[model samples]
Target: MKIKTKSKKVNKAWLHDHVTDPYVRLAQKEGYRARAAYKLKEIDEELHLLKPGQLVVDLGAAPGAWSQYVRRKFAPRDAAGGGAAVGALNGTVIALDLLDFEPIEGVHFIQGDFREEAVLAELQAAVNGRPVDVVISDMAPNLSGIEVSDAARIAHLVELAVEFSQQHLRPDGALVCKVFHGSGYSQLVDLFRSSFRTVKPIKPKASRDKSSETFLVGRGLKQQA
Candidate 1:
């Protein structure tokens, strides 16, 4: 007789859902680390962020898809538009996350908690005293299912990202961060408005319709100075 176990049903259900997930198929075909790449790509298309030979900082950049996009975008090209060798001093992308990620071409990976001062210092040092052109934070707290607590944690992280942007971004740089629409959402938008010349909230097509997550883009950092 075959043995029955409760785990089998759960596993089957998970497999079914994963298999039917459109993003999963799309990611496989496109070679993105996660479906999240589409979200960044959509935002970039709308905002025209990311340029050749610019300094970019990516927070919570594990899996390295975003870094991959950055690398391709800044790949060396000749005046005739031929693919050229990437110079040692070309554009730089620094990816930071608590989880380990395999290194990608043209990306410097730092495995550490972004909340730590040491990690931030190392990232800053990597930039070699030059202000970053763009900062993207995809950081999200582990959900506990407690609405208020989760919102607070998310808000705190957004605040930390804001503070980092204020300190490290160039006057004309930009910041894009993931935020959930929950308690303190409006206040967070207000804070960003005060800090940046323009604040635009974006929801990418790659994002699940049921999700509360949105991306806040702060532009024209020079206004604060």
Candidate 2:
């Protein structure tokens, strides 16, 4: 009974916070699928990583708020198309996730586990030989509440994103990946430093104050990696 009561209280607290979150209200007004779009928007505003006509790969892109944000960036800035959804997209977006998402116009969707070789092959095929201008990963493994295990899971996903970036991103392209600040965090930072000419860690205001998540942006891959 105590466990159930505690769980219920936690749920209520989270619900209240979500309802009161300004980002959530703004997302509803802007037609984004989730509040997460603001997080990417803030990061892009800070870094200027996204641009028109770029080919982007989105990893762990379920619920697709980030993709929606990118779509808006690619929206043509003409009288009829400016800031409109499904209007003349000036870029390419390919999104992959373990869970299926509702279709977004002008975005290709793939459903698969990213850790598998076959899925990676399919993702590459979808790229269709174009040099990716940016790769963004928000992938995080399902947490089991074991700190060590969770940290390893997070590190593995980040590492895979790095490897993919090394193989597919343009020499001057960027990779943005979500990583938690805990065990193995420094090692991930070191990995980024070794792989990219520039690395930055960004925590967006849309992210919850208590969340450990931060984004690592790696740009301009170094040779001999």
TM-score of 1: 0.87
- Return the number of clashes found in candidate 2: 0
| Residue-by-residue lDDT tens digits, candidate 1, 90-181 | 58889999999877766889999888899988887887888889999999989999989988988888899988899889888899999998
Cα lDDT of model 2 overall?
0.94
Q: Which regions of candidate 1 are displaced past 4 Å?
A: 1-17, 78-90, 222-225
The list of candidate 2 runs beyond 4 A from truth reads 79-81
Q: Give all candidates' CA lDDT scores.
A: 0.84, 0.94
What does candidate 2's lDDT look like per residue over 1-225, in tens digits? Answer: 999999999999999999999999999999999999998999999999999899999999999999999988999889365666786899999999999999999999999999999999999999988999999999999999999999999999999999999999999999999999989999999999999999999999999999999999999999962
